[model samples]
Target: MTTMTPPVTPPVTALNALGFDRPAADTRVVVAMSGGVDSSVVAAMLAREGFDVIGVTLQLYDHGAALGRKGACCAGRDIHDARAVAARMGFPHYVLDYESRFRESVIDDFADQYLAGATPVPCVRCNQRVKFRDLLATARELGADCLATGHYVRRIIGARGPELHQAADPARDQSYFLFATTPEQLGYLRFPLGGVATKAETRAMAAGFGLDVADKPDSQDICFVPQGGYAAVIEKLRPGAAEPGEIVHLDGRVLGAHRGVIHYTVGQRRGLNLGGGDPLHVLRLEPESRRVIVGPRAALGVARLRVAEVNWLGDGAFADAPPGGWRAQARVRSTRPPAPARVLPEGADTA
Candidate 1:
């Protein structure tokens, strides 16, 4: 009894590059490869660090239709390229068929939003619904410690938790499109290319790793949209979405007839074909009334507008917003710099 038992010693835990308390080999990472130079470099870099890397590519649409399509991710050609990179890097690769999920989540929403006279960013929807949500879940099912991606956005560790930040390279930053990433998803996500200065640097890394995708062109436009034809895709998904309607001026004047409300977006000025008059911009679209409302550029300006589905990444609960509203930077467009603004909470999800 006096010589009872030896004291147990706890193993020391150290933070690796991914902030995981384990060796690189012990940390299993699932990289979402889009078959581009950006993703290829990420997979290769992790493999070089001796991590257990598994590359997964989602076939979001019909590969048969995407066989010859260029400048799109998750296509037939892209899947092939992703597989090649995985083979070269000596990591396991997989292709998951997510066509049905994509249609329900992204494609259908895209067409519906257009029908409702609102322009939808399918890329953001795809990221929010498919890649970060579904694919991240798949990674967990495979026993992965975290999911890594080639997105040009940083996940900085803050006192509160992981905070999403703009990439070091502003020119290639994709932070705007990734605004929907929730706190929980941010915890399990990693962006290896976030700190890279330029696309050329990523390409260089790919070349250094001897990956064949080093020179592959970057994915352009929406992955599912072919030939940059948004209207055609919408029409195919929802027949007769392009119903012809009257293009009316602001002052209750019918200027011309437009093919459909889907063809013109807000703030559009060209292709009106009104035949010589003051330039008019698309003030808004009234799909229910089948009206393409147009007016002078001055009519497009607005001091304030309500935003819905607000994803708060800031401190504390969204309901904590003061009655006067909170000071914040608002970005209306991804290409535009964020402007000073005050955000008043309308509800838990609206602002």
Candidate 2:
């Protein structure tokens, strides 16, 4: 009888959340620490997994001014909390002073957009220019194979490389603020906590790791905008920015006086100070004439609107889509789900 030999099994390589098929010690990862519960949990989880992790916190605003400012990120307390988490996790940490860069990249742009009679999303701008853009570069220079964040957005490996998706927990989904994450940035970035079910789960994880920030409050406002006020900051940055303007009704009647067009936004209803027969809403802001144009709720409805600076991330090019345009899901605002949309390119710059 001939002896039979069993076939040998190939070694199974395990992949970490950062997607490296090697021991965590050999793969270096940079975690953007905000000293909040979510980010602190991310760093702690990676550290617990025996990864070679380096924690980096960005001081994006004035340290002195940010003291005792609760519910704000990238401030003095946040930096301290990040350092504490790193100490507990036994990982090296760094604090980068990015105040000037943030002001020019995000804060200034935010004020300018408001002055131009448009609502601005500074969180998106910060992610686009400061974190995903500048900070991602810093990670590469530090020899980090990947940069991980605590953001609530998913990155799935698809046929066409990495594809961005909403977080598993829809309530905590932050895909809107991250829509501008370029393909290149998406390739180098990872979100470890995106798959987690809820904030309570994150807090539990933080407690397990002995991180002090386990109970830290989530940041509620723009880090640079103290007490939820950006108008004052804008006025200080750009002297004479809040010039008086007229609030005019859609029917060409002057309704009231507005301090400035910057004080209002499209579709705003509150603080109009109009003694009216029926409730009115702001339809649009005319920056050219510094006017806040109001109308009935019907006028605020829009069948279509122009969106500029398109960033294409879907499969295939725009021209490859059907003649009528790509059948896709899109959201006009973050509060709503992406409904059915027929995206057609209006020009080179907009859709």
C-alpha TM-scores of all predictions: 0.95, 0.95
Which parts of model 1 have CA positions greater than 4 angstroms off? 1-13
lDDT of 2 by residue, 1-351 (tens): 999999999999878658988888888899999889888889999998888899999988886776787768878888889999999889999999898999899989998998898889999999999999999999999999999999999999899889899999989999999988878899999999889998889899999998888888889888888887788888988888889989998999998898888888888899999985899999999988989999999998777777797777889875566788888898877888888888888765478
TM-score of 1: 0.95
Worst 10 residues of 2 by lDDT: 341-350
User: In model 2, which regions exceed 4 Å deviation?
Assistant: 1-12, 347-349
Error of 1 at 219 (Å): 1.5
Every model: Cα RMSD to truth? 2.7, 2.4
lDDT leader: 1
Output candidate 1 Cα RMSD: 2.7
Candidate 1 lDDT by residue in tens digits, 141-240: 9999999999999999998999999999999999999999999999999999999999899988999999888888877778777777899999998999
